[model samples]
Target chain A: MNFFGIPDIYLVILGLLFLSIIMAIIRVIKGPTAPDRIVGLDTINTIVIVSMIIFGLAAGSVIYVDVAIVYAFLSFISTLFIAKYLEGGEF
Target chain B: MLNQLIDIVIYILLAIGVFFNILAGIGLLRFPDVYTRLHAGTKCTTFGSIFLCGSVILYGLRMWILGNVDGSIWVIHTGIALVAILLTNPTGAHALARAAHRSGVKPVGAVIDELENKPTKKSANKMEAKK
Candidate 1:
Protein backbone atom coordinates (compact mmCIF):
# COMPACT_ATOMS: atom_id res chain seq x y z
CA MET A 1 0.00 0.00 0.00
CA ASN A 2 2.76 2.41 0.88
CA PHE A 3 4.84 2.48 -2.23
CA PHE A 4 8.03 0.63 -1.49
CA GLY A 5 7.21 1.31 2.16
CA ILE A 6 8.18 5.01 1.92
CA PRO A 7 11.53 4.60 0.24
CA ASP A 8 10.22 4.80 -3.29
CA ILE A 9 8.01 7.74 -2.42
CA TYR A 10 11.05 9.46 -1.01
CA LEU A 11 13.06 8.55 -4.06
CA VAL A 12 10.57 10.49 -6.13
CA ILE A 13 10.66 13.38 -3.70
CA LEU A 14 14.44 13.37 -3.97
CA GLY A 15 14.10 13.65 -7.71
CA LEU A 16 12.04 16.78 -7.22
CA LEU A 17 14.63 18.08 -4.83
CA PHE A 18 17.22 17.50 -7.52
CA LEU A 19 15.17 19.55 -9.93
CA SER A 20 15.06 22.34 -7.37
CA ILE A 21 18.81 22.21 -6.90
CA ILE A 22 19.31 22.66 -10.62
CA MET A 23 17.03 25.68 -10.64
CA ALA A 24 18.92 27.17 -7.73
CA ILE A 25 22.14 26.70 -9.62
CA ILE A 26 20.71 28.60 -12.54
CA ARG A 27 19.85 31.50 -10.26
CA VAL A 28 23.23 31.45 -8.58
CA ILE A 29 24.91 31.58 -11.94
CA LYS A 30 22.67 34.21 -13.46
CA GLY A 31 22.01 36.39 -10.45
CA PRO A 32 23.05 39.97 -11.12
CA THR A 33 24.83 40.49 -7.80
CA ALA A 34 25.56 39.32 -4.28
CA PRO A 35 22.20 39.75 -2.60
CA ASP A 36 20.63 37.78 -5.38
CA ARG A 37 22.88 34.88 -4.55
CA ILE A 38 21.98 35.15 -0.88
CA VAL A 39 18.30 35.11 -1.74
CA GLY A 40 18.82 32.06 -3.87
CA LEU A 41 20.72 30.29 -1.13
CA ASP A 42 18.03 31.06 1.39
CA THR A 43 15.43 29.62 -0.91
CA ILE A 44 17.50 26.50 -1.38
CA ASN A 45 17.86 26.04 2.36
CA THR A 46 14.11 26.16 2.90
CA ILE A 47 13.53 23.69 0.13
CA VAL A 48 16.10 21.39 1.66
CA ILE A 49 14.29 21.46 4.98
CA VAL A 50 11.06 20.41 3.32
CA SER A 51 12.83 17.57 1.58
CA MET A 52 14.27 16.43 4.86
CA ILE A 53 10.81 16.22 6.31
CA ILE A 54 9.68 14.14 3.41
CA PHE A 55 12.63 11.88 3.86
CA GLY A 56 11.72 11.47 7.49
CA LEU A 57 8.22 10.44 6.54
CA ALA A 58 9.58 7.89 4.13
CA ALA A 59 11.85 6.37 6.71
CA GLY A 60 9.28 6.54 9.55
CA SER A 61 12.15 7.18 11.96
CA VAL A 62 11.10 10.64 13.19
CA ILE A 63 14.80 11.38 13.71
CA TYR A 64 14.96 12.99 10.29
CA VAL A 65 12.20 15.35 11.37
CA ASP A 66 14.20 16.22 14.47
CA VAL A 67 17.19 16.99 12.33
CA ALA A 68 14.97 19.06 10.09
CA ILE A 69 13.76 21.17 12.99
CA VAL A 70 17.31 21.89 14.14
CA TYR A 71 18.44 22.60 10.62
CA ALA A 72 15.54 24.98 10.18
CA PHE A 73 16.65 27.12 13.12
CA LEU A 74 20.29 26.97 12.11
CA SER A 75 19.52 28.06 8.59
CA PHE A 76 17.41 30.89 9.89
CA ILE A 77 20.32 32.10 11.95
CA SER A 78 22.67 31.79 9.01
CA THR A 79 20.31 33.70 6.76
CA LEU A 80 19.97 36.51 9.27
CA PHE A 81 23.70 36.74 9.79
CA ILE A 82 24.29 36.83 6.06
CA ALA A 83 21.63 39.48 5.62
CA LYS A 84 23.12 41.59 8.36
CA TYR A 85 26.49 41.25 6.72
CA LEU A 86 24.96 42.33 3.45
CA GLU A 87 23.45 45.37 5.16
CA GLY A 88 26.98 46.57 5.78
CA GLY A 89 26.37 47.26 9.44
CA GLU A 90 27.69 46.02 12.75
CA PHE A 91 25.69 43.06 13.93
CA MET B 1 -16.12 4.10 5.52
CA LEU B 2 -14.70 6.76 7.83
CA ASN B 3 -11.36 5.04 7.75
CA GLN B 4 -11.40 5.06 3.98
CA LEU B 5 -12.15 8.76 4.05
CA ILE B 6 -9.16 9.37 6.28
CA ASP B 7 -6.93 7.45 3.94
CA ILE B 8 -8.10 9.56 1.03
CA VAL B 9 -7.46 12.74 2.96
CA ILE B 10 -3.94 11.69 3.78
CA TYR B 11 -3.06 11.01 0.17
CA ILE B 12 -4.54 14.30 -0.95
CA LEU B 13 -2.62 16.17 1.67
CA LEU B 14 0.57 14.49 0.61
CA ALA B 15 0.13 15.50 -3.01
CA ILE B 16 -0.78 19.04 -2.07
CA GLY B 17 2.23 19.43 0.17
CA VAL B 18 4.69 18.17 -2.37
CA PHE B 19 3.12 20.27 -5.10
CA PHE B 20 3.40 23.50 -3.16
CA ASN B 21 6.94 22.72 -2.18
CA ILE B 22 7.87 22.35 -5.81
CA LEU B 23 6.09 25.59 -6.53
CA ALA B 24 8.16 27.29 -3.89
CA GLY B 25 11.33 26.13 -5.48
CA ILE B 26 10.18 27.23 -8.93
CA GLY B 27 9.07 30.60 -7.69
CA LEU B 28 12.37 31.09 -5.96
CA LEU B 29 14.10 30.49 -9.23
CA ARG B 30 11.73 32.55 -11.37
CA PHE B 31 11.21 35.67 -9.32
CA PRO B 32 13.10 38.79 -10.42
CA ASP B 33 13.91 40.70 -7.22
CA VAL B 34 15.24 39.82 -3.83
CA TYR B 35 12.00 40.76 -2.11
CA THR B 36 9.89 38.78 -4.54
CA ARG B 37 12.20 35.83 -4.29
CA LEU B 38 11.99 35.94 -0.53
CA HIS B 39 8.23 36.05 -0.71
CA ALA B 40 8.10 33.02 -2.95
CA GLY B 41 10.66 31.15 -0.92
CA THR B 42 9.09 31.87 2.44
CA LYS B 43 5.40 31.56 1.72
CA CYS B 44 5.39 28.50 -0.50
CA THR B 45 7.38 26.42 1.95
CA THR B 46 5.22 27.52 4.83
CA PHE B 47 2.04 26.39 3.13
CA GLY B 48 3.70 23.21 1.99
CA SER B 49 4.82 22.34 5.49
CA ILE B 50 1.28 22.63 6.77
CA PHE B 51 -0.01 20.17 4.25
CA LEU B 52 2.87 17.78 4.64
CA CYS B 53 2.62 17.76 8.39
CA GLY B 54 -1.13 17.43 8.19
CA SER B 55 -0.70 14.35 6.06
CA VAL B 56 1.53 12.81 8.67
CA ILE B 57 -0.92 13.75 11.37
CA LEU B 58 -3.78 12.28 9.46
CA TYR B 59 -1.92 9.03 9.02
CA GLY B 60 -1.11 8.99 12.71
CA LEU B 61 -4.72 9.59 13.67
CA ARG B 62 -5.85 6.81 11.41
CA MET B 63 -3.47 4.48 13.15
CA TRP B 64 -4.64 5.69 16.54
CA ILE B 65 -8.24 5.05 15.54
CA LEU B 66 -7.19 1.57 14.64
CA GLY B 67 -5.66 1.34 18.15
CA ASN B 68 -1.94 2.11 17.86
CA VAL B 69 -0.40 4.37 20.53
CA ASP B 70 2.54 5.59 18.43
CA GLY B 71 0.29 7.63 16.16
CA SER B 72 -0.53 10.04 18.96
CA ILE B 73 3.12 10.77 19.52
CA TRP B 74 3.64 11.39 15.84
CA VAL B 75 0.66 13.71 15.67
CA ILE B 76 1.66 15.72 18.71
CA HIS B 77 5.28 16.17 17.63
CA THR B 78 4.31 17.24 14.13
CA GLY B 79 1.97 19.82 15.61
CA ILE B 80 4.82 21.29 17.62
CA ALA B 81 7.03 21.44 14.57
CA LEU B 82 4.34 23.22 12.58
CA VAL B 83 3.91 25.73 15.35
CA ALA B 84 7.61 26.42 15.32
CA ILE B 85 7.59 27.06 11.59
CA LEU B 86 4.54 29.28 11.84
CA LEU B 87 6.12 31.45 14.52
CA THR B 88 9.57 31.79 13.06
CA ASN B 89 9.52 31.61 9.26
CA PRO B 90 7.86 34.93 8.54
CA THR B 91 9.98 36.74 11.11
CA GLY B 92 13.07 35.44 9.43
CA ALA B 93 11.83 36.68 6.08
CA HIS B 94 11.08 40.08 7.56
CA ALA B 95 14.52 40.35 9.08
CA LEU B 96 16.18 39.35 5.82
CA ALA B 97 14.14 41.86 3.84
CA ARG B 98 14.87 44.67 6.26
CA ALA B 99 18.54 43.88 6.14
CA ALA B 100 18.53 43.84 2.36
CA HIS B 101 16.76 47.17 2.14
CA ARG B 102 18.98 48.82 4.73
CA SER B 103 21.96 47.56 2.80
CA GLY B 104 20.68 49.53 -0.22
CA VAL B 105 18.82 47.05 -2.35
CA LYS B 106 16.09 49.16 -3.86
CA PRO B 107 12.88 47.39 -4.74
CA VAL B 108 12.37 46.93 -8.44
CA GLY B 109 10.67 49.95 -10.05
CA ALA B 110 10.55 52.05 -6.92
CA VAL B 111 10.72 55.82 -7.05
CA ILE B 112 11.74 56.71 -3.54
CA ASP B 113 15.05 57.24 -1.78
CA GLU B 114 13.58 57.51 1.67
CA LEU B 115 16.19 55.60 3.62
CA GLU B 116 19.07 57.58 2.19
CA ASN B 117 17.51 61.04 2.44
CA LYS B 118 17.96 61.50 6.20
CA PRO B 119 21.34 63.09 5.32
CA THR B 120 23.20 61.51 8.25
CA LYS B 121 26.26 60.68 6.20
CA LYS B 122 26.00 63.77 4.04
CA SER B 123 25.52 66.07 7.04
CA ALA B 124 28.65 64.65 8.64
CA ASN B 125 30.50 65.24 5.41
CA LYS B 126 29.21 68.82 5.31
CA MET B 127 30.40 69.42 8.85
CA GLU B 128 33.83 68.12 7.90
CA ALA B 129 33.86 70.47 4.89
CA LYS B 130 32.91 73.54 6.99
CA LYS B 131 35.62 72.83 9.51
Candidate 2:
Protein backbone atom coordinates (compact mmCIF):
# COMPACT_ATOMS: atom_id res chain seq x y z
CA MET A 1 0.00 0.00 0.00
CA ASN A 2 3.04 2.21 0.28
CA PHE A 3 2.36 5.47 2.12
CA PHE A 4 -1.26 5.65 0.99
CA GLY A 5 -2.70 3.53 3.77
CA ILE A 6 -0.18 3.78 6.59
CA PRO A 7 0.29 6.93 8.61
CA ASP A 8 3.28 9.18 7.99
CA ILE A 9 4.60 8.46 11.46
CA TYR A 10 5.55 4.89 10.59
CA LEU A 11 7.46 6.15 7.60
CA VAL A 12 9.44 8.60 9.70
CA ILE A 13 10.33 5.92 12.22
CA LEU A 14 11.45 3.65 9.42
CA GLY A 15 13.67 6.38 8.07
CA LEU A 16 15.28 6.80 11.47
CA LEU A 17 15.83 3.05 11.72
CA PHE A 18 17.49 3.06 8.35
CA LEU A 19 19.80 5.73 9.63
CA SER A 20 20.59 3.62 12.69
CA ILE A 21 21.49 0.67 10.53
CA ILE A 22 23.78 2.80 8.43
CA MET A 23 25.73 3.97 11.45
CA ALA A 24 26.11 0.40 12.71
CA ILE A 25 27.34 -0.63 9.27
CA ILE A 26 29.99 2.03 9.49
CA ARG A 27 31.20 0.52 12.75
CA VAL A 28 31.17 -2.95 11.25
CA ILE A 29 33.28 -1.78 8.36
CA LYS A 30 35.91 0.13 10.33
CA GLY A 31 35.95 -1.68 13.65
CA PRO A 32 39.59 -2.30 14.64
CA THR A 33 38.96 -5.51 16.52
CA ALA A 34 36.72 -8.52 16.07
CA PRO A 35 34.64 -7.82 19.16
CA ASP A 36 33.97 -4.32 17.91
CA ARG A 37 32.50 -5.70 14.74
CA ILE A 38 30.50 -8.23 16.69
CA VAL A 39 29.17 -5.48 18.92
CA GLY A 40 28.15 -3.47 15.89
CA LEU A 41 26.49 -6.48 14.32
CA ASP A 42 24.61 -7.13 17.54
CA THR A 43 23.37 -3.56 17.58
CA ILE A 44 22.28 -3.86 13.98
CA ASN A 45 20.47 -7.09 14.75
CA THR A 46 18.41 -5.52 17.55
CA ILE A 47 17.53 -2.47 15.48
CA VAL A 48 16.59 -4.67 12.54
CA ILE A 49 14.11 -6.59 14.65
CA VAL A 50 12.48 -3.39 15.90
CA SER A 51 12.22 -2.06 12.37
CA MET A 52 10.69 -5.28 11.17
CA ILE A 53 7.90 -4.84 13.68
CA ILE A 54 7.35 -1.26 12.57
CA PHE A 55 7.35 -2.29 8.94
CA GLY A 56 4.77 -4.94 9.67
CA LEU A 57 2.49 -2.33 11.15
CA ALA A 58 3.06 0.14 8.38
CA ALA A 59 2.59 -2.38 5.60
CA GLY A 60 -0.45 -4.04 7.13
CA SER A 61 0.95 -7.52 7.55
CA VAL A 62 1.31 -9.83 10.54
CA ILE A 63 3.93 -11.97 8.86
CA TYR A 64 6.63 -9.38 9.36
CA VAL A 65 6.23 -9.61 13.11
CA ASP A 66 6.68 -13.37 12.93
CA VAL A 67 9.77 -12.90 10.85
CA ALA A 68 11.12 -10.48 13.38
CA ILE A 69 10.80 -13.05 16.14
CA VAL A 70 12.66 -15.69 14.21
CA TYR A 71 15.32 -13.15 13.33
CA ALA A 72 15.76 -12.33 16.99
CA PHE A 73 16.36 -15.96 17.92
CA LEU A 74 18.80 -16.57 15.12
CA SER A 75 20.78 -13.42 15.81
CA PHE A 76 21.01 -14.23 19.49
CA ILE A 77 22.46 -17.61 18.67
CA SER A 78 24.92 -16.07 16.26
CA THR A 79 26.04 -13.53 18.83
CA LEU A 80 26.71 -16.30 21.32
CA PHE A 81 28.66 -18.27 18.75
CA ILE A 82 30.80 -15.29 17.84
CA ALA A 83 31.47 -14.52 21.47
CA LYS A 84 32.59 -18.08 22.08
CA TYR A 85 34.92 -17.91 19.14
CA LEU A 86 36.41 -14.71 20.46
CA GLU A 87 36.92 -16.30 23.83
CA GLY A 88 39.03 -19.08 22.25
CA GLY A 89 36.77 -21.71 23.73
CA GLU A 90 36.10 -25.09 22.17
CA PHE A 91 33.07 -25.44 19.94
CA MET B 1 -11.08 11.56 20.89
CA LEU B 2 -9.67 8.40 22.48
CA ASN B 3 -8.08 7.29 19.24
CA GLN B 4 -6.47 10.67 18.92
CA LEU B 5 -4.97 10.30 22.34
CA ILE B 6 -3.65 6.88 21.45
CA ASP B 7 -2.04 8.29 18.34
CA ILE B 8 -0.36 10.97 20.40
CA VAL B 9 1.01 8.39 22.80
CA ILE B 10 2.25 6.30 19.89
CA TYR B 11 4.01 9.29 18.41
CA ILE B 12 5.74 10.09 21.66
CA LEU B 13 6.95 6.53 22.04
CA LEU B 14 8.18 6.49 18.48
CA ALA B 15 10.12 9.70 18.98
CA ILE B 16 11.77 8.49 22.16
CA GLY B 17 12.59 5.09 20.69
CA VAL B 18 14.02 6.56 17.52
CA PHE B 19 16.08 9.12 19.41
CA PHE B 20 17.74 6.56 21.68
CA ASN B 21 18.39 4.24 18.77
CA ILE B 22 20.09 7.01 16.86
CA LEU B 23 22.15 7.83 19.90
CA ALA B 24 23.17 4.16 20.07
CA GLY B 25 24.43 4.34 16.52
CA ILE B 26 26.47 7.40 17.29
CA GLY B 27 27.93 5.82 20.39
CA LEU B 28 28.91 2.69 18.51
CA LEU B 29 30.85 4.80 16.07
CA ARG B 30 32.43 7.27 18.47
CA PHE B 31 33.25 5.17 21.54
CA PRO B 32 36.93 4.23 21.72
CA ASP B 33 37.24 0.85 23.44
CA VAL B 34 35.37 -2.38 22.94
CA TYR B 35 33.98 -2.22 26.47
CA THR B 36 32.87 1.34 25.94
CA ARG B 37 31.35 0.47 22.60
CA LEU B 38 29.52 -2.48 24.14
CA HIS B 39 28.24 -0.23 26.87
CA ALA B 40 26.80 2.13 24.32
CA GLY B 41 25.75 -0.34 21.68
CA THR B 42 23.95 -2.94 23.76
CA LYS B 43 22.14 -1.00 26.46
CA CYS B 44 20.78 1.87 24.39
CA THR B 45 19.40 -0.41 21.70
CA THR B 46 17.72 -2.63 24.27
CA PHE B 47 16.18 0.41 25.94
CA GLY B 48 14.99 1.76 22.63
CA SER B 49 13.59 -1.56 21.55
CA ILE B 50 11.53 -1.76 24.74
CA PHE B 51 9.75 1.51 24.05
CA LEU B 52 9.42 0.87 20.35
CA CYS B 53 7.94 -2.57 20.78
CA GLY B 54 5.80 -1.30 23.66
CA SER B 55 4.29 1.31 21.39
CA VAL B 56 3.43 -1.32 18.84
CA ILE B 57 1.80 -3.50 21.47
CA LEU B 58 -0.28 -0.58 22.61
CA TYR B 59 -1.35 0.06 19.05
CA GLY B 60 -2.22 -3.57 18.58
CA LEU B 61 -4.24 -3.65 21.75
CA ARG B 62 -6.13 -0.56 20.75
CA MET B 63 -6.97 -2.11 17.43
CA TRP B 64 -7.93 -5.41 19.01
CA ILE B 65 -10.27 -3.57 21.29
CA LEU B 66 -11.88 -2.19 18.18
CA GLY B 67 -12.59 -5.76 17.03
CA ASN B 68 -9.80 -6.46 14.56
CA VAL B 69 -8.65 -10.07 14.65
CA ASP B 70 -5.22 -9.29 13.31
CA GLY B 71 -4.58 -6.96 16.16
CA SER B 72 -4.78 -9.72 18.73
CA ILE B 73 -2.26 -11.85 16.88
CA TRP B 74 0.02 -8.88 16.42
CA VAL B 75 -0.02 -8.11 20.10
CA ILE B 76 0.85 -11.67 21.07
CA HIS B 77 3.65 -12.14 18.54
CA THR B 78 5.15 -8.73 19.07
CA GLY B 79 5.16 -9.52 22.74
CA ILE B 80 7.04 -12.74 22.13
CA ALA B 81 9.66 -10.85 20.19
CA LEU B 82 9.99 -8.24 22.91
CA VAL B 83 10.58 -10.90 25.51
CA ALA B 84 13.15 -12.50 23.29
CA ILE B 85 14.99 -9.22 22.96
CA LEU B 86 14.91 -8.61 26.68
CA LEU B 87 16.24 -12.06 27.49
CA THR B 88 18.94 -12.17 24.87
CA ASN B 89 20.44 -8.70 24.73
CA PRO B 90 21.88 -8.39 28.21
CA THR B 91 23.23 -11.93 28.35
CA GLY B 92 24.86 -11.47 24.98
CA ALA B 93 26.40 -8.23 26.14
CA HIS B 94 27.74 -9.94 29.22
CA ALA B 95 29.24 -12.72 27.16
CA LEU B 96 30.82 -10.18 24.83
CA ALA B 97 32.34 -8.25 27.70
CA ARG B 98 33.81 -11.37 29.26
CA ALA B 99 35.18 -12.56 25.96
CA ALA B 100 36.78 -9.21 25.30
CA HIS B 101 38.42 -9.24 28.69
CA ARG B 102 39.61 -12.85 28.45
CA SER B 103 40.95 -12.30 24.95
CA GLY B 104 43.18 -9.50 26.24
CA VAL B 105 41.52 -6.54 24.58
CA LYS B 106 42.42 -4.15 27.34
CA PRO B 107 40.37 -1.06 27.84
CA VAL B 108 41.82 2.32 27.02
CA GLY B 109 43.42 4.39 29.83
CA ALA B 110 44.84 3.21 33.13
CA VAL B 111 43.22 0.54 35.24
CA ILE B 112 43.72 -1.07 38.66
CA ASP B 113 43.80 -4.66 37.32
CA GLU B 114 41.69 -6.02 40.15
CA LEU B 115 40.20 -8.78 38.04
CA GLU B 116 43.57 -9.59 36.55
CA ASN B 117 45.14 -10.18 39.94
CA LYS B 118 42.31 -12.25 41.40
CA PRO B 119 42.36 -14.85 38.64
CA THR B 120 46.12 -15.18 38.69
CA LYS B 121 46.18 -15.53 42.45
CA LYS B 122 43.61 -18.29 42.34
CA SER B 123 45.57 -20.14 39.72
CA ALA B 124 48.76 -19.81 41.75
CA ASN B 125 47.08 -21.11 44.89
CA LYS B 126 45.76 -24.13 43.03
CA MET B 127 49.21 -24.88 41.63
CA GLU B 128 50.89 -24.57 44.99
CA ALA B 129 48.34 -26.90 46.60
CA LYS B 130 49.00 -29.43 43.83
CA LYS B 131 52.77 -29.23 44.54
Best of the candidates, TM-score: 2
| Residue pairs with clashing backbones, model 2 | none
Error of 2 at B31 (Å): 1.2
Cα lDDT tens digits for candidate 1, B69-94: 98787777777777777777888788
Colliding pairs, model 1: none
Position A82, candidate 1: lDDT: 84
After superposing candidate 1 on the true structure, give the runs of residues whose Cα lies further than 4 Å from its correct spot.
A1-7, B111-131
Label model 2 with its docking quality class: medium
Per-residue lDDT tens digits for candidate 1, residues A2-70, read 665665555776687668767777787888878778777877777777677667777777777777778
lDDT of 2 by residue, B61-100 (tens): 9999999887899899999999999999999999999888
Name the 10 consecutive residues with the lowest summed lDDT in model 1 chain B. Answer: B113-122
Error of 2 at B8 (Å): 1.3
